[model samples]
Target: MQWRGRRQSSNVEDRRGGGGMFGGSGRMGGPMRIPVRGAGGGLGITGIIILLIAAWIFGINPLELLSGGGSLGGGGGQTQSRTVDTKASDEMTQFVSTVLAETEDTWNGIFQAEGQTYKEPRMVLFSRQVQSACGTASSASGPFYCPNDQRVYLDTTFFQQLDQQFGASGDFAQAYVIAHEVGHHVQNLTGILPRFNQMRQSMSPEEANRMSVRVELQADCFAGVWAHFTDQKGLLESGDVEEALNAATQIGDDTLQKRSQGYVVPDSFNHGTSAQRRTWFQRGVQNGRLSDCDTFNNPV
Candidate 1:
């Protein structure tokens, strides 16, 4: 987590001011604010998750729900907006950029060793709400990588949610989140995403969710691969690895579901359990090889 004085990534797209024609991002070819209705006729957290995942894996827009002047009816039709103090966010922004740059360095080296070129993906920084090829998303939707857009969308506020809501702390935990998303970018670049999507299309919801768990666990392992490189370069300090493991444990689908719903539903888990996540991540850290990060072929 010793990121100070390190190089920052120029690939960061700052849409915090809501600049550009498409709400905030010039690269996204749509209006800033699009009306969306929550499923079950309620605008709840589940609604945001649906919007996010639809955009993330399927590249489909769920705005059709709003075509009938539908309502996010569970709560009052209120959009959550907060005036961000740019000055206060500068440090966190810098830290994220630095981690991104390091990830680029690590992946670039690994790819080169295999006679391949690594295509560095861009990261979009937004606040409150943002638009992408995936669709518009509220901060509530959390950080996601859209395979179609080849960019990672992050709302910095999620870092706060990680600490206050999930009980995951430390700068290394934040780096783990970014690294996990970048891991998805790696999967996309290597053509894993398209094949996975094709395979998911013919499966039942339960089976598809199981596939998603494998996908997420693989990303967690890839994050550990990046950590392996970071540690080799003496970037990791005391307690850094523990921070990331704590993060993986805290955000397990079973843990989150149990916390929110007061029950666990295994059939609906798209991400692996806490033990699975921690084990797969450790596998990557111990081997530091792409072959070892294959969560699909190997047992979780």
Candidate 2:
């Protein structure tokens, strides 16, 4: 993806070693997991690793995946947190910081063009567990953005799992993950996330899940929007777009569910289907316009 020699963001909060509050007891979960409600949850390192191993050996089971915790969502979660002084992998840290800086550049330009001021969001790099405004999360919780705090929480080890377990690799794929979370931050700044959450509160579970799908798909499109700018700046290589599309396909709710289980349950999907994900992402990449990312008003 040609990310080397790029500017790194200074907003990164590194809490890797064992010096922070949750120090002694928090470094448990290894595989990333994002809770559905972004509330209280805990997965021992042994338990989460077992789940990941089971999925690796068996198949990527969505049911088993959500069984331990839940799907990713936003809200105020009970905060149980800690941090360490140890730095993260130097290479990974540099790569993420670069990505964040690039996104800031892209979004800043976009917002300015729209006659709005862009508020940059911070990214928090943590290891096993860290507390967020949404709640405390383990590595198993996966990477997520907490709108309440306007920060993106990430666990770098998840990149390994993305390659080895999810069959999604490449630097661009990793960037897509970061971009998608940052996309949520964009939504938060634009007041989309808060309004959507308000609407979700009055809907049925199925309805809320559908809304969640649109929200996530929009974030995917936002990632593509960022990709469009990167491509325009000649930063994208030949296969970079494909890497991101493959990642979007692999992480689709239906794809994950089918891999984990033998069948599909449409109702349980919080994220869009594989085709839908790829399509929405392509929409943004093709147009590079925010109007094209209206997953809620237009057909996804």
Alpha-carbon lDDT, every model = 0.69, 0.70
Candidate 1: the clashing residue pairs are 23-32
- Which candidate should be chosen as best, given TM-score against the real structure? 2
> Can you write out model 1's per-residue Cα lDDT over 46-102, one digit (the tens) per residue?
223323343345444445321212211112212233433334558988888889999
Candidate 2 lDDT for residue 237:
97
lDDT of 1 at 231: 93
Q: How much does candidate 1 score in TM-score?
A: 0.77
- How well does candidate 2 score on lDDT at residue 265? 84
Distance from true location, Cα of 26 in model 2, Å: 20
- RMSD vs true structure, all candidates: 12.1, 12.9
How far residue 37's Cα lies from its native spot in candidate 1, in Å, is 17
Candidate 2 regions exceeding 4 Å error are: 18-89
